[model samples]
Target chain A: MHTLDVALGERSYPIHIGRGLLDDPAPILARLKTPRVALVTNDRVGPLYLERVQHGLERAGVRCTAVVLPDGEAHKDWPTLNLVFDALLGARCERSTTLIALGGGVVGDMAGFAAATYQRGMPFMQMPTTLLSQVDSSVGGKTAINHPLGKNMIGAFYQPRLVIADTATLDTLPDRELKAGVAEVIKYGLIRDAAFFAWLEDNLERILARDPDVLAQAIERSCRNKAEVVAADETERGERALLNLGHTFGHAIETGLGYGEWLHGEAVAAGTVMAARLSRDLGWLGEGDLDRLVALFERAGLPVQGPKLGAERYLELMAHDKKVEDGRLRLVLLDGIGASRVSDAAAPERIAAAIEACCA
Target chain B: MHTLDVALGERSYPIHIGRGLLDDPAPILARLKTPRVALVTNDRVGPLYLERVQHGLERAGVRCTAVVLPDGEAHKDWPTLNLVFDALLGARCERSTTLIALGGGVVGDMAGFAAATYQRGMPFMQMPTTLLSQVDSSVGGKTAINHPLGKNMIGAFYQPRLVIADTATLDTLPDRELKAGVAEVIKYGLIRDAAFFAWLEDNLERILARDPDVLAQAIERSCRNKAEVVAADETERGERALLNLGHTFGHAIETGLGYGEWLHGEAVAAGTVMAARLSRDLGWLGEGDLDRLVALFERAGLPVQGPKLGAERYLELMAHDKKVEDGRLRLVLLDGIGASRVSDAAAPERIAAAIEACCA
Candidate 1:
């Protein structure tokens, strides 16, 4: 077992990573402020892990109720998010009731948000069951439900009491989701962890093969990087904006294609390639470096090419992203393999060129 | 103008109170982050003051787009909140765009919640047009929408950049609404300031008559007390809970009678009487103190009697309140005429007695 702390002053919390950590569950159980807890999961992941988690909590003398939402990115909307609220309120769950998010990103985001807003707020913990969530979304306090017009357009930065990334849960995860998780894992390295980037390059094969130690290390390092960034800037005020490296482009793709049409990590994977390509166009990144970055995403089974959305359409959609400031779209682009920073160009032509060049 | 600050460390902001405070618009405009602004108001308050606020922002170089919602507590829900999001997103307002909440409590709560969630959040200013909002809800950062099961069941603890409490706007406020605002003003005194409570007693006629100087002093003092408590406990972790002296009983009345049936301040007025009665029953408050509190509500033309929702029903409803810690109903009972504290009684019998006694 490995533990990392996101040092956010009084808001600091621990992220636990290990295989079969759900079996004992002492740490997670001990964190609950209430004897009764609501476990929010989804149909896809619930069947595989719900009973185990319930038994684990029950073993520790805590009462557990489960709310199983339908699985998919599309479910990250208001109506669906309300199911968790209805289940909790219908049960007459008091403010002290702890919400345990027990699925992937969609469930985590919705449950975290439900915990944030339910009765002004309630205590919650994250038990991420997927690679993508374990390494990125689950570690951060950013929680939201998608708006009809945009992805994750409405949400809050409400932190959880604890985050449990039981890597064994990923044993049941699909290959596509596994690869998508690697996209964010690569992101942490690209943003600020050059050593971890080289480590990922060397251990990509073992990671794909599901070597437990290698995967555990991968999760820990990614979380460490993310935790540090979040701790420094809990609300994405300044340095934290660097974490949205490809999200500006990625959100545009997601919103333009309709939320669930493409997986989030898939869009981000493609988006990162575009950011790298843009960096090259601006002469900040060498052609060889851009090629290597695209090759890395391709090797991870991610899409190197973005969908053929027109540059104007992409630009229009990107403007609605949370990153847009003062009418200019600020994007986190790579200056090199392991360096990223936020930049806004006055010239639109270059952005159009990058969008044109990176698409299928 | 009377400007007081809510000293919440870095999150601190100023509350400006007086006649024609909205007309000048310099301080308010300087607080906005972008040239564009989205003004969220309601039908009732919109036709009365929207044009003035829009003109104010425009005069200061802001492009204001208005999204007027239906008025009243009933509209403080998700669908109404979405209207604000739709207006901003449809217009493609960037993240830096500021949301100006230009109405009473309902508008301020929903608009503040909108600002907290829109694009993760945007800068927002509060221009509370109603006395209830100006004295209480707008001064603090507690923004929320109602759920069918409870009042303020869904919301966030998000603060505004600046609060413009234009006492002059109250000139157009309905008599009932103006009296409702006094309930919260009275709350400030009941919880912390005996001097303010005595001042309210001495100047009830002047306040009811809408004497600008007296009302401004009341608003400033009320805001100062609220700002101090909020600064000490921004998230209602400790001392802040004392501010909700009558809120538990008050929210029960509001939720029990249906959201819009009784004005929030009216319910709070009756609730405060109930709290005083409970304090007397508990031997913490003298009979004279209770009489003084009830008489103050009477002079303000606020309801001193709660609707007969039944004791058991009130208990059941309050159990779902944000204050319920591990199933114990925490009530803020008055220690005397000007002192209050949070206490979780083991028995609900006294609360039941108070509810039964205070009801019409």
Candidate 2:
């Protein structure tokens, strides 16, 4: 097992990465001093792993209530978030009551956000059940639900009390979902660690196959990198924006395609490839680098191309993305495989050309 | 002007309390390194004060785009919040854009929450136009919109970069609204400062009359008290909960009555009276203490009795209040005129009697 701490002082929490950790609730529930808890999950994840978490919490002598929300990215909005509050209220949960988010990115984000606002903030534990959540969403403390105007338009940088990432959960994730999680794992390497990227290049298949050891290592490294970035920039003021390497483009795709159609990780995968291509076109990277990114994404069985939304619609969708500023589209482009920078000065024509190339 | 710093490190901001501070934008706009801003106000406050703030910001070389939302607590929900976002996006506001919230608690909370979430948070100034906002809501960064299920069900604690409380704006406020603000001012005295409570008792009429110096001092003292508590417990872990002294009860009143029918301060005014009475019944407070609280609320022309929602219904309403935890009702009872404690052990019979006492 590997551990990383997101240092937010009193809000600080640990990300524990390993296989079979889900069955062990000591680390996650130990921090919750409350006697009662409400485990928030979704229909998809609840039937699979809810019992394991509920049993772990129950064994700890904590009374638990499980709320199963409908599963999907489209459901990650105000209405669904309200359901969380309704369930908590129905259970008569209070300020001291802890909320356990036991699912993928959508569930974690919504549950964490509900915790963040419930009674003006409550302690929550993140037991991420999806590969995507383990590596990215569950670590950063960025909890939010999407708004019709934009994704994650309403949220907070509220840290959880603990994050328990049991690699075994990934064993049941669909192949596409597994590939999606790998996209974020690949992101850490593409943005900050060439060595890790090389490791990913060598172990992509093992990760896809849910090899416990390799998956645990990858989740740990990804969390460590994310934890450091979040600790330094808890609110994504500057350096943290580097973590959104493919997100600006990815958000455009997600929104343009009507959010749930393409999995966030899949869109991010295609977006990363596009970002690398744009970097190459803008003379920031070599063609070989773009090819390497494309090959890695393909090897992970993730998409390397976005929907055929024209440049104008893409621009409109990108404008609504959380990344754009003052209507000047800011793209997080790779300076190389191991570093990234957010730039609004990237020529629109070049970006449009890259989008065209990716779609074509 | 008396200034109090919220001490949230980078998120720390100053609350400037005095007469005519709105005319002086130098200190408030100083934090805005950018040249553009978007001022969010509402119909009631727009024609009265938005232009003055716009002039102040423009004179300070900050281009301003003003968005006027409908006035009322009922309007402080998602649709109204979206208006502010749309105006900013239409104006091509950047992440560095600073939002100036120039209205009462509704506008301040909604705009602050918008700033907190827009582009993953941005700097905003609170130009509180109502007495309630100036004293309480504007000082702490607890911004939110009412969910259909409850008031402030959706929001964040994103502090403002500057809180500009123009005592002058209160002059244009309706008598009832002005009285509502006093409820919060009285709250500070009840929970933490006996001396301030005594002063409020003596000067309630002058404040209601909009006496500039008296109002300024009242605003300054309330803000200072809130700032001290917030600095001690930024996330409401302990002392900060004291700030919600009347809020738990007040939230029930607002939610039970279907929000906006009674101004927030009016509900709080009545709720504080109920809390004081409850404390006395529980032997935590004396008769004189309850009378003093009731006297202060009456002097402010605020409600002393809750709506005639049956005791059973009030209990049902209180049960859903964010303060209730694990089916245990946590009441913030007054230790005296100026001290409070959050206790979940308060007997249900005593609480029921208090609610019954408040029934008309």
Candidate 3:
């Protein structure tokens, strides 16, 4: 087992990366000073692992209640988030009662958001069940639920008390979802770690096959990169924006494709390719690097081309993205793998050309 | 103007209390680096003072967009909150955009929560327009919305960049609402400020008349008391619980009666009386002090008795209150006005007796 701590003073928590960490509740439960707990999961994850988590928590002398929400991004809304509070209140959960999120990005985000707002805030542990959640969403303190107006429009920078990424759960994730997770994994490489990208290129098949060792290394590296970024820019005031490399364009795709139709990682996979092309046009990235990025995404069975949303519609949707500032589009562009910068000065023609090329 | 800072290190902000402060947004706006502003208010507050605040912000070169929500406590929910984000997003608000809440407790809490969640949080200024808000809700940074199951079931302790309580807004407030605001004003005295309590007893009438000088003193003292409590315990971890003197019982009343039926202050007024009576029975407070507390509540025209929810139902409702821990009832009992302790060991029979006495 490998542990990386996100140094946030009193808010600091360890990210445990291993094969069966979920079965061991001692460390996670030890961090929680309370005896009562509410386990938040989704239909896709509850039947598979919620019982085991409940058993572990109960054995540790903690009372437990489970709130199983419908599984999907479509269910990540206010009504769904309220179900968590309803379950907590019905069970008479107190502020000291901890929440354990036992699912993928949707569950983690919604459950974390529920914990953030449940009685102002409560300690929660992230037990991410999917690749995307295990590597990216689970490590960052960013918790949110999608608003009808925009994705992740309502949320808070609420960090978890602990993050337990059990590699065993990845066995149950569908192939498409696994590839989706790899999209985020690749994101870290393209934005801030060339060595990690090189490693991913070499071990892509091993990760695809759910090799525990390969998967563990990938998750650990992604979390380490994210933890470092989050520690320095806890609230995304500056350097944290680099983490949104393809998110500006990805959010537009997710919203335009009618969220949940395309997985977040899949949209991001395509968005990153578009962002790389934009970087090439801006002369910040070479054609060879862009080709390698596209090849990697293609090998992972992810899209390297944007959806057929025209430039005008793409601009409209991206305008609603949370990253936009004062009517100006802010794009996270690649200076080179392992480095990134956020800029709104990219000419409209360049952005349009990249959009057209990626869509075509 | 009297300026008292809520000393939370980097999160610290100044609370400016005085008459005619609303006309001067220079100090507050000067601290904010954003030139784009989103003004969040309600229909009632919009026509009354939104123009002046907007003019002030705009005159200072800050582009402002006003989002007017429905008026009253009933509107403090997800739907209304979504409107604020919609307006901000429609205006292309970035993470740097500042949100100015320009109404009462409802607007302040909703807007503050919106700011806390918008793009993981944006700078917000509390331009509290009502007495209840200026003294209590605005100063503490406890932002939330009532859930169908309970009051403040969802929220965060997101502090604002600045709090501008223009005492002049009180002139336009209704008499009932003015009395409601005094309930919180009376709270500071009951929790940990005996001298302040004595001052309220002496100047209750003057404060009701909206006496500029008296009102300013009252607001400043209330904020200073709250700021001190919050600084000592920002997350309501220890000493801060004392500030929730009547909140435990008050939340039960609000939840039992259905939010918006009784104004927050009215419910808190009755809750305070109940808490004092219970404190007296526990031998922590004298009968004379309880009578004095009840008299103050009555003079403010606030409810001194709770609704006819039976003892069993009250217990059930209070159990669901966020304050309850490990199935033990945690009540903030008064040792004396301005001195309180959170005790769960108080006898159930004594609590039942206090409830019976108050209801009778």
Q: In terms of TM-score, which candidate is strongest? A: 3
lDDT of 3 by residue, A38-143 (tens): 9999988999999898999899888999999999999999889988888988888888889999999999999999999899988888999999999999988888
What's the lDDT for all of these models?
0.88, 0.84, 0.88
**TM values, all candidates:** 0.97, 0.94, 0.97
Each prediction's RMSD to truth: 1.7, 2.5, 1.5
lDDT of 2 at A248: 79
Give the distance in Å from residue A5's predicted Cα in candidate 1 to where it truly belongs.
Answer: 2.0
Computed on C-alphas against the true complex, the DockQ of each candidate is 0.77, 0.51, 0.79
Q: Candidate 2, residue B175: CA error in Å?
A: 1.2
Angstrom error at residue A93, model 1: 2.5
Better of 1 and 3 by DockQ: 3
Candidate 2 CAPRI category: medium
- Indicate whether candidate 2 or candidate 3 has the larger DockQ: 3
**True contacts recovered per prediction:** 0.94, 0.49, 0.94
Which pairs of residues collide in candidate 2? A94-B325
Model 1 chain A: lowest-lDDT 10 consecutive positions? A343-352
Per-residue lDDT for B233-275 in model 3, tens only? 9988788888777777777788887778888898888888888
Off by over 4 Å in 2: A325-327, B90-92
Which of the two candidates, 1 or 2, achieves a greater lDDT against the reference?
A: 1
Lowest lDDT sum, 10 consecutive residues, model 3 chain A, at A319-328
